[model samples]
Each structure stands twice: as structure tokens, then as C-alpha cells.
Target chain A: MSSTLLRTVPALRGALRASGAPKAAGAMASTSFVRGKATLPDLPYDYGALEPHISGKIMELHHAKHHQTYVNGLNSALQTIGEAESKGDFTKAATVAPLLNFHGGGHINHSLFWENLAPASGEGGGEPDGALKKAIDSDFGSFDTFRAQMNTALAGIQGSGWAWLVKDKAAGTLGLVTRANQDPVSGPYVPLLGIDAWEHAYYLQYENRKAEYFDAIWNVVNWKTVAGRFEKT
Target chain B: MVNIGSLWQYLALHSTLSGDSTNTNNTANNLAKMGLAAYTLPALPYAYDALEPHISAQIMELHHARHHQAYVTNLNKALESHVAAVAAGDVAAQIALQQVVKFNGGGHINHSLFWKNLAPAGSEDASVAQAKGLVAEIEKTWGSFDGFKTAFSAALMGIQGSGWGWLVKEAGNGAGLRIVTTKDQDPVVGGDVPVFGVDMWEHAYYLQYLNGKAAYVENIWNVINWRTAEERFAGRSEEKTEL
Candidate 1:
């Protein structure tokens, strides 16, 4: 989700070179000023779909309020950066970088997270099979071992963060990685499945026993999405 | 390990003496106003195990030694960086460092107050009678002490993320008491007096209470240092010796 703007930058420059001077100037406007606002994506299931594992109230607040704040932050940060840069106030533009990173990463992470979840009554919990399962087994010895390792990583986070099942794009090997705060998985890693370890993720339902929330989330894991991302990577 | 002098100095210099909390964005301004002195972890008022049974020694040790220390350490680092940024005329760097400053700064401030806000369960300060003025104000504001407890507990539970619930004295002429929650590491800045604060972050209770946070909240009253709340409420804490 965050890569959209990044991917457009080079493409916009390419258009500028390919067009005539008048069209090139027009392309410059789009490239320099136009920004697509990040929007909160709709959840694939009802707020209560993952109930008993994650409560409806948690889901509602997480999606509607928390996620919405990130979206607004990202848009506001981008607007500030754009306006600052246009005015030649690089300091102002640079000052907004942290907000851009936090909110942008937050927007992207939550967007992916909502999709990676489904109702436990449907395609939620259970282990992945086929190629994804084969890769997990090869990389981590077995599926159970992989799940346990992920849970360990989740538990080990000292503060707000996430544990992810990621595919190393270069090696095509599966591994576990954790990020502090809203940092999104980037570089060569493709996040297959992410488990949010932030207190808000489970403090309401699981309270301080976050391990229960960690263990229970697998009941609605949505391995189908995990498999799709795994194969595509 | 409880250094009474530094705690007194901290409370005197920062929360009360500063007397400039009205602007919500005044954290950086306050840091500059104070000449950007480094912050150190204030010693707890009691031994780690003093609040045991209600709050375990393990929780207090980790909460104070680990969590609060990190905030103090990080806040000083952010301040140092901000100093260098200001010297070099690096506006972006200075601005970029504000969030960390606010977070770690608030963390330091809140934890400092939180430590002094608690006492050993059976200690004299733990009794409501020690907080005579605050109790009268609480009864006036909420109609009854039980009512205030119920409302405060609800506020604590209602926090969606890591934060603190504070019983504060409104800054204006009325000086009314109110329950408020600040998200993440944000302190009850502005002119309001945070008579007492409850750390709602999972680290404060997760070790002993597990998913039973309600039990922790209920048990907390047994350890609350109402004497400190009374001083803060009566506005006598500014005198420094009242505590």
C-alpha cells in the first residue's frame, strides 16, 4: 500500500521525458504536486467475525478510530511536505519526515493486516498447505515449529511492535522478523502475515496475557492470504 | 535507594515551579525554558517490595528500573540531539526530534509522579484519611468516594492503548477535580494539577494481574499514597516541605 507513491515517482519522471516540452511541463505538475491520499480499506469480514479470539469492540476501534487516525496523519504529512518543498522550505519538509514515515507505515501495515484476517467461521485459522507449507517446512523445520517461533518473537517485543512471517525476496526463504512501533517491513522482505504486538491489539481482549491473544489469533489467521502472498513473492 | 532530595527537587522544579503547562505543545518550549538540563531516573519512594501483594516486587522493579530508566535515558538523548540541532541551525532535525522528546519527556514526568503516588499497602499514607482535602474534593466532585473509584476504574479500563489515567485539579479558579486519560506517554500537561496518576500501561500490572486488570485496579487503592494526593490537591505541595 505504501509503495504506490514510491512506484509512481519513477514512472512520472519517465512520462516527463517521453512527452513534448508543453506536455512535459504538464507532467511535471502531476509528478511534483499530485498525491493520492491513503484511505482506510474495508475489512473483508464483519467486526465480530473474529470474535472469541478478538472481540468486536477491539475490531471496531482498531479499524474505525485507530486506522483512520493513521490515514489522516499520512495525508496531512504528505500535504505539509509538498507545500513545504514547493515553498523552498526544505527544513519544514524534512521536519515532517518522521510523521510521514510513522503514519505512512501505519497506514500500509494496517491495510495489509485487515486483509490478512478473516472470520474463524470461514477461511480464518489452520495451517497453510501446498508450496507455502513446503517453504515453511524447509525454512523452519515444521509448521508447528514456525508458529511457536513466531509466537516467541511476538512475546519478546519489549514494547509496541509487530512480528511478521516474511519472505526474503532474494532467497525466497521464509523467516520471522519483528518491527518496533509502526515500522513497515521493507527492503528485500515481503511480509506474508503480520501479528500486531501493540497493547491495543490485545489489551482489551487478552489484557496483560498477550500470549493468549497471540495464540488465539491463529484461530482466524487467514492462511489463504498468506499462501497467496507467499506464491506471488 | 530512595533519594528523597532528588524527588523533591524534581517535583519542585518541573511540575509545580515551572508553572507553564497551559500550552499543549509547550514540552519543547519548557525544555528550552529550563535550559535543557539532562533528566535522570528519580528513585522510588519505597523499596520494590513495599507494595507487594497488591503490586508485586517484580512489577515495581521492572517498571521503575527498566521502563522508567529507559524513558529518562531516551529523553536525555533526544535533548542532547535537539541541542546540537539548534546549534547547527538544523530546523528539520529539531522539529523531527519533537515526538521523541514529548514521548520520552512525558514518560519521565509521569513515571516520576507515579512512583510517589503509591505507598506500601498497610502504610499510614495508604489510608484515605491521609488525603483529607483530596477526599473532600473527590466527594464534592463525584458525590462519594466509591463513585470516584468506579469512575476512575472505568477511565482506566476505557484506555485503548498504553497510557495513564489521572485524577487532576482543573487549572482555573474553580479547581474542580476531574478524571482524564492521556494516550501513550503524554502527561497531563497544561495548568492542571495531576494530584495522582495511575499507570495503565500493561507493564504496570501484566506481570502480577495477567488478564485480570480489574483486580489490579481494585487492589491499587490499597497502595495509593493518598497523602501525596492531598498535598497536591490542597496546593500546598508547591511549598516543597508539605510532602
Candidate 2:
């Protein structure tokens, strides 16, 4: 009984404290009220790690400058929405939706894209094995076929966008999906691997020869990470 | 039975509601300012195949028909919703709709001008002599026509993303020429007159030029409508670009 009382005392005290607190204070103090700011994730490898295939210069600018802008934009949009909603300015909150969608999707896509790449010398490239290979073969006929299809999708994108290898949730089958601009992969599809086709992705090294960049990217694809995501999904 | 005082009060109220104090006597202009007027896609001055060889027929068709048409359709839709939102005092919807209006509206305005700014590769209007007044101004500003071309081409090449490079005449009396660039579909705003602009968006040259932007830039001068440039420079163009 004494041990039980000891455990119950803290719970009782917490309940009393919560009840006695002012409504605003209680809302503020809730753990759920804390908002996490989106941040630029640290690159897993050195900027120059994917060298020859993708230059160190491009990696530095893309990761440090481009990705950071998205992170900042996402945070700003979130903060604006929160403040607008607090003040009952629903219009202002709604106004921020596009920015939030754009910057938020950019942050999410870049984070996933960074993790999807690895140095060619290490655990990067090569064909997937185990269940991943089976699924790819079953869905796309062969590994080469799957690659060609992804590359074709990448080439078909008219403007800034990404071509993703996605798995339909209900169907559990692999598919190729393309998104315009920074639109995130959502609604029943799980993005397994994404290749950014924005001009900024390869303009410095490849310029107008985007097909070469597409072919070269396959050499540095981190299939291990893709396999992990596939199995988890 | 209305008194003179009441008549004045009603007119004042009407003007305030119409949101056109400056154009109270003009009903059409008032309707336009109040977002009641819808934007339409301006037809290309020349045929789709007119600017071929330099800019392909395929590119011109796609750029004008599909892309510019989408902007016009979306802009009209956004403006209609904005009008309703304003009437209903839905500030959130109005704010949310601002960027779409700006982007699509600018696209319409820019493309409308771009069509008029181009002539056939060897047409009379394409000759530099048609813009003798503007040519002299360009010479004064950048030393020579080649000097100006070199400078403008550099600006176009320097753009990192989709944008436009323009030759604008400064606002006010005795305005001077300036080279400027705007990102995406942003139009030349404020007091300056955009004499001419070059679309640096990848879609503008990607299909034909295919990463050879320098070649496209060098070739564009052959089709430039110097006549239109002269009209815009002299501030006497009949092109109704008031968006």
C-alpha cells in the first residue's frame, strides 16, 4: 500500500497542478504544444565523396545553399501559420499554405534524396538483392528494365521536378512516379528512391546533357538505403 | 425626391465601394480596377511557324498555346475567386490567392509582349533601322549596338534559374536605358518601360537549343522586332498591356 501511495502521489500532484494552472498556461505547458523547426540535415558523407560522378562544387552549393534555403523557408512558413492561427487570421494562415507546401516538400524531398545517395566506392550502386531484388524483378521484369524506365521518367519531366521509385501502399507493388517542382510523394505511395531533375541538380557539370547525368547517377545510388525503405514499407 | 446633399453622399459612397476614386467618371476602367474584368490570352501577332529555324514551330506552339493559355485560364480563375473573397471579406482566401494572381498575370503580360516583340527572321520590322531612335539611344547607353548586345547576352547567360532579361527605359522625362533581369514570371513593375525582353526560361529554348543557350541567344537577334521596341521606347505603343 505504501509503495502504491508513492506512485499515486506524483500522479495526483500532476493532476492537481494541471487543474490549478491558468487555461493559457496549461495550453502552453502541454508537451504537444512544442513545435519542432525543420532543419537542414547534416550530409552523411563528405561533399567530395560522390566525386567524378557528381562534382564537389555542385554538392557544396546544393547541400549548403539550396537545401538551407528550403529549411529556412519551411520554418518561416510554419511560424507564420502558427502566429496567424493564434491571432484568428485564417486568411494569413491559408496564404502560407503554398509556401509551406513548397518549402516543406522541398525539405522532405532533399532529406530523402541525400540519404538515397552514397559514394560509388563504398556501399553504393550495385543491384539490390534479397526481397528488394525479387520485388523489382516481379514488378519491372528486370533490374536493367527498372533503371531504363526510371531514366525515361526522369527525361520526360518538362520542368523542375523529381522522378521517384514509389511503392503503392495497398497494392505493395513498385511503380515509377513523377512530381512537379517540390511536391512530396503522398497519398498511398511510399517514395523509395528519388532523383532530382532540376537544372540546379546537374547544370554545372552536365549542363544541357541531362541524360549523361541520369546515367551517371545510377553508379552512386545507395541501393542499401532504398532496400531498407522498401522492406520497412 | 433626392436632395442635392444626399445625391453627393450617394455618389461618394458609390465611388468608395467601387474602389476607384481616380477613375470615378469611367465605368469600364472602374470595373477593371475592381477585379471585375477577366484577362484573356492575347493571340500571337505572327503565325506559329513565322519564327522557325531560330525558334522551332514546335516550341512556339507549345509555349504560346499550352503554357501561356494555362496562365491565362488560371489567372482568370484566381481573379474571380479573389473578387468573391473580397466581397465576402474572406481575407485568408484573398492572401492565399495573391501569388497565383501575380505569377499568372505576369506570364500573360510577358508573353503578350514577347509575341509582339518578335517578327519573321527576315521581315522589314526585324530590321534595326526601324528602331533608329532606340538604336541611337542604345549606342549612347552602351557605346555601340554590338556593345549592348554583348552586355544583354551576358545578363541572359548569367541567370541561374528561369527568368527574363530586359532593356528598360527609366521612368520620367529624359529617361535612360537600363539592363535588368526578373526571376520566373515576374514582370517589369513600377515606372520603367520594358522596351524589350528575352525569355531565359529553359522551356523557351530547351526543345530546339537543348542546352546550347549561347547559340539561341546569338540567333534571337535575327527575329527581334525592332519596330515594336521603338514604339515601346518612345512610350507610344498601342499594345494594351495594362494588367
Candidate 3:
């Protein structure tokens, strides 16, 4: 119960104590929120879980190295943000702004992304369900068609960006938006689905062939996780 | 006055009220949670032969081969360089490479999705249901598909820099198909899903439309498979709330 309330706030100590999740509240009071800033999120599968479609080498590079870089960069940015805030140096804070947005965004995204994939164990090892599924159908019209559109958007990204199935916050809608760089998805939305079009995400196994990778990614998408996220949001 | 995004959201609500598929897989079903910036290239939904003629075998070949491939190679190199620099503890390199990492990395991600955005561009049956959804959304938002065509075209033409014009979900509320313009690789959503997008980048049209982003944007719609768009719209209506 206490855990559910933590996600919305940057701090939980006072809130917890006020709410009476005693043990949790005490623990929150005793701990720091940014323990390590960013760290490698635990992986749910072997690095080779999506092999053939997504190679082991690519996984290693992506998670171990790329995501780690985001973590580290995010940490550094946060540290700087703190220092600048202390000195009342808005300029310095601003200087570190993009770092916070990009690397920080990377850390957050990779974290969600990790849970969004699944292995091909059954009907779709990691396919979506519940409200997300109903939403997918209502929005895209059908499962097969959704796949095609996602593939197209995944393939259509020009330059560097992400293909996303984002939920609009203010207007309460779901729509597709392509983001440039590590830009946080705009329009105040929740990420229902995300596709990394970055080359490193698939270059090794698929080589320069991105289209091939799109087909295979379906084999491992974590629909359960995505469906869960949909439920919560 | 239900907009495209809201129309889908409303549909999702209806589906939820009706009660259909079980959602057990979504929360726990993740085959792999790969990185958006890591090593994953999307595969083509259709074969090279699949999108011939309207798209041309030659265009697809070069675009994917030369253009898209370059993004992959460059992005990897940037990562490699960043790793080495960080190991050596070079702050200068880290700062300098930030732009390289974002720009090149962004390029790789964007183009990958773009490839799949086009199928044959001529197929009328590619997910006819979704296409109809797009049409319906168009009508809902702008009174008709033709109105959607004009608005989307105008939005694309009005973009001042290299970027994209998207029909994206409005965020937590549900899908309100808003025509948004994002500049210089700016992301359409930090939260919502990016279902369909039109590239207004010069590279996307220079070879074809050259300076006329309007012409290119207009022409691309000719190939728009409304069925696919409708499918995406239908999926947007997919419910998360249990009945």
C-alpha cells in the first residue's frame, strides 16, 4: 500500500509518516532517494533471450554499456544539479539541464523498456493484456494491424529518435509520437509502448537490416509488463 | 466533438465495459526489455519485394542500405568512443561526445521506424480496419477524412525546420489525435505512444520533394494505408481498465 504512493513524489519520508505506513515511513525517513543515482537495472532474462531477432552481442552492448552510460551520466547530472542548486547557480543548473533530460531520460526509459520485453515461451512470451490490449484494439483496430503500424513507425524514424505509443496526459488520449534524441516524450503522456530505433538496439544480428529486426522484436515484447503499466496508469 | 485520440480512448472505455481478453501476460510477459539506445534494428514487416513500384525497389534498397545502415554504424562508433573516453576519465570527450551520441543515436532510432512507416504505399488493404479508424478520427476531429488531409498537410508544410508532424495520443487522458510538430529530432512523447508520423526532414524529401516539404508531405499521404491507421486507432481503443 505504501509502495503505491511513492512513485508520484520525489520524497516519501514525511508523506509516509503522515499516512502511517510506519515501518516504510521510518525507512523512508532514514534513507536517501538518490542512493546511487543510476545503476544497472536487473535484467529479467538472459542476455540472449531474444537471440536471432536481437543478438547477445547487441544486448551486452546495450545494457551493460549503453544503459550504464546513461546511468552514470544521469548520476553526474544530478550531482551537478544539486551543487548548482546549493550555490543558487541557475545558469550552472541550466547548463546541466540537457544532461538531466537526456541521460536522465535514458535511465528512466531503459528501466521501463527492460520490463517491456518478453521471451517467446507461448502465445507471445511477453505480449500485452487487459486494458492495454483493449486499448490497442480500440486504438489500432486489431493486433495484426497494430503490429504493422508499430513496425512502420519503428521503421520510419528519421535520424535518431524513438517510436512510441504514448498516452496523452491532459487530454486523456493515446497517440504515436517520435522523439528526437533522448528527449522525454512531450505532451504530458504515459508511455504505453516504446521501440528503440537506435542502430545498436539491433545492428549486430540484423546488421544494416532494420526491417528484419522489427519482425523479430515481437517475439520478445513483454506484453504482461506493458499491460500492467497500462492498468496502473 | 470527439477527437481522434479521445475517440480511441472512448472506444477503449467501451471495450473495457464489454470485457474481453485476459491481461495476465501484460504485467509479467516481457520476452526482452531491450534498450532504446542499444543494439536492436527493426526488421521489415514486408520483404524487399513487398514494397515495390510505388516505393520502388531501388529507393528502398538505397534508403535502407546506404542511409539507414550509416546511422547504425555511426551510432555504434559513438558508443565505442564514449566507452573509451569514460574509461580514460576524459570529461572533455564526454561533453563533446554528448551531442554526437544524441544526434547520431537519434538518427539511428528515427530512421529505423521510418522504414516500416512505408509498406508499398499503394496497398489499399493493409489493415483496412485501422485505416478506417484514421478516417473516422479524421471525421471526428475535422469533420471528414478530406479535412484531416488538409490539416495534416498544412501542419506538415508549416514546420520550419527538420523534424516530424505526428498524429499522436494526447497522454494519460486517452488518444486525442493532435497534430503536433517536433523540431530537430524532438520527441513527440516522453509518455504516449507514437503510432504514426510523417517525416518533414529535408532528407526525407530532398531527393523527391526537394525544397517543397508541402509537396512531399502531400504525396506521402497518397500512399497512406488508411486501413493501417484505422487499425492503430482501433488498438488505441483497447482497454486497460478491467470490466
Best by TM-score: 1
**Residues A85-202, model 3: lDDT tens digits:** 9999999999888778888777777777767875576334544666777777888887788888888888766555677787777765567877766676655888876778765576
Error of 1 at B5 (Å): 42
lDDT string, candidate 1, A95-142, tens digits: 888788788888888988988998988999988999999998999999
lDDT of 2 by residue, B33-101 (tens): 564765667778888999989998877987898778767776766675566455555678889889878
**DockQ (model 2, Cα):** 0.03
**Candidate number achieving the greatest DockQ relative to the actual structure:** 1
Number of the top lDDT candidate: 2
Worst ten-residue run, lDDT, model 2 chain A? A26-35
Interface RMSD of each: 7.0, 7.8, 10.5
Misplaced by over 4 Å in model 1 are: A1-191, A199-227, A230-233, B1-36, B238-243
Which lDDT tens digits does candidate 1 get at residues B1-243? 124534554444445323433332344455665576456678888999999899989888877887787787778667756765554556788898898888888888889888888999888989899987788888988999999999999999766446899999999998899999997788887889999999988788865775567898899989899999898888877522311
Where in model 3 is the C-alpha error above 4 Å? A1-36, A122-127, B1-65, B68-243
**Residue pairs in collision within model 1:** B21-B190
Candidate 1 lDDT at B158 equals 61
Which is superior by DockQ, 1 or 3?
Answer: 1
**Local error of candidate 1 at residue B75 (angstroms):** 0.3
Candidate 3: C-alpha RMSD after superposition:
24.1
